[model samples]
Target chain A: MNYPNGQKKIISKQATSWQSKKSFSNRGMSLEDDINTTNQFYLDIDRAVIHKKPTPVQIVNVHYPRRSAAVITEAYFKQASTTDYNGLYRGKYVDFEAKETKNKTIFPLANIHEHQINHMKSIVEHEGICFLLIRFAAHEETYYMQAEKLFPYWYDKLHGGRKSIPYEKIKLDGFHIPLQYQARVDYLSVIDKLYF
Target chain B: MNYPNGQKKIISKQATSWQSKKSFSNRGMSLEDDINTTNQFYLDIDRAVIHKKPTPVQIVNVHYPRRSAAVITEAYFKQASTTDYNGLYRGKYVDFEAKETKNKTIFPLANIHEHQINHMKSIVEHEGICFLLIRFAAHEETYYMQAEKLFPYWYDKLHGGRKSIPYEKIKLDGFHIPLQYQARVDYLSVIDKLYF
Candidate 1:
């Protein structure tokens, strides 16, 4: 498919059915959708109260038709100053951002934002559960890197280091999140091992 | 002015600069906007962290332009299961819903959803700061009613009684939130009186 401005769209041969079925086994669906489903499952089972924060959108213009509902005619996404997910679990606040990439060698630090890093740092200082869920999509691997481990490297990146976190370094510092039938992400298992 | 429905359109007058400058003595802005501005001010001052939860919308269709941004062609408002705002304040969880009505006689319980009532109950049970900011727009009066005070009445609504909370009852039960320049709503002052 060709987009405007002469940009070519590369279509992958990934089957929709296979992706839906193996969603728990690999980084199948978009990270956001998978995490939302996982959070709902957790809520259903009374395991935790985690939730995906809704995308902040600024609605500039709204049209209210007499017979129909209100229509958001114009809106734009606002820059989020916090992590994607947060909730209370076992009397502790859990805060995290989940990201997935197709790259096999490294996870780019550019995927994380400075404001998000600062938010995580504040959460850590306040004795909250803070971490990042990084998924290596090509290898179907997911790792939970604690905020303390990522803080030093993030500061180093500011001082002219590589813009990507190497897979080997992630493997050395992060804990592998278990894949489960119910809690697909099962990040709490990693949290249990590291914090609890 | 007139609308398509053959009804005269009464334009809401915008406050002039001089009028706005004297707003601290008057009713000032809408309760929703005041709370939002107060939250932003709190964020800036490194005070209690709080935010208004985004309105949930279910997208039915989307028009993805080749070059331009994606347009939401069709969508519907989803009933929110929780309150409008929630976040941490002084290491404590704070959750609340803000509602406004021009009615002078009473505040209808119908405005409060059953799911939201249940959610507030759970939050209170978990020892969180939970309340409702009720605005009697006709009187230009705002009150902060604790969730505990409202729950019994909410549960009683299903039994047999008026399906609304009368203004006289609220005057007796709710705390009158003071209007302020910076913290417009200044609900924490009520919190200080009630909880602290």
Candidate 2:
């Protein structure tokens, strides 16, 4: 999925420079930034209606002042009970969780919570198209692994087997998602190839 | 769809009394409480996978203590871009917004925002089962109206027609969601009647 050498170099160099310099104040954002940009492009063109669900927060306290908005004063992040992104595509239900890991060898199992795994299982049971978008940041590669494929690993972990999935195993089993200019992660292309 | 006379009377009396007594601290909840309870029952029995999206929030500032969970110090409620709830059911994507109105004669269009109407239009265009759940609190009734049926009114409002939909019109055009002891707002029966 490479473009011309000069073009790829220029684009990535600018992204790396900006992300490294401008985002220390907002650390750990650029990983999902590509997907967000991609989803927005999809929405703008009316290709799909996917959206990243809002981060779940537990509001414990609020302050209301006259002639102003109510401000949340105390809150905490709650564990999400479902996948991060889901929407309709081609008249089918599409659901997925996107995650990025820096580890070069294996994707640690702990990156996904138990409840999210259960939710994915329920989606599959109901015949919805469910999958995971995993990015290896160091390798600059994304893979689309269907939820059905992830269950064996989840069961292994439950039965006290390997705690992480090897990079090689994912490379063999998962489809490599080509990064497109407009749809950055471009997982929908993989979904098209697999299903349609 | 009335249950045994005594059963319905007891449940209504208990709910009205409890809601009046205990829910002033959490205003505007019981209307959705029925739906939420219904959804939970659906989940427990593996009937459908539906969820009310967590309220969208924009977090501006947070304070992280060395030994405690991060506390959000400043945040604001953000206008939701899509409907309030969505999930897969019987291999179909179901998306809907739930609104409760105290008005007995009319369901105000002002309860829904312009952007949300645009989003619902997109959902219907993509062939998802998109609808609205309107609860007339004063009348103790909930009605399900399809998104396609709503476009005319939405456009009429845009062109300086009636600003609100009358209760009588909703009663005629929409399907009255029967209240079951288990599936309190039983809209799925209407869905089966309409689509399947």
lDDT of each: 0.72, 0.80
* lDDT, residue A23, candidate 2: 38
Q: Predicted candidate 1: interface RMSD? A: 11.6
Best by TM-score: 2
Residue A156 local lDDT, model 2: 100
**Interface DockQ per candidate:** 0.15, 0.29
Write candidate 2's Cα lDDT for B1-196 as tens digits.
Answer: 1211112223233323422332421334465687888888889999889998877866667776676666677666667889989998999999999887878999889989898899999899899999999988777788999988888888999999998899999999899986678888877788889889
Q: Candidate 1 at residue B24, lDDT? A: 32
Error in Å for residue A123 of model 2: 0.6
Query: How big is the positional error of residue A1 in model 2, measured in Å on the Cα after superposition?
Result: 37
- Listed for every candidate in order, the interface RMSD values in angstroms are 11.6, 13.9
Compose the digit string of candidate 1's lDDT tens values, residues B64-147.
556654444444445676788876665666789988877898999999989789778767765678899998887878899999
- lDDT string for model 2 (A9-31, tens) is 23233324522332321234454
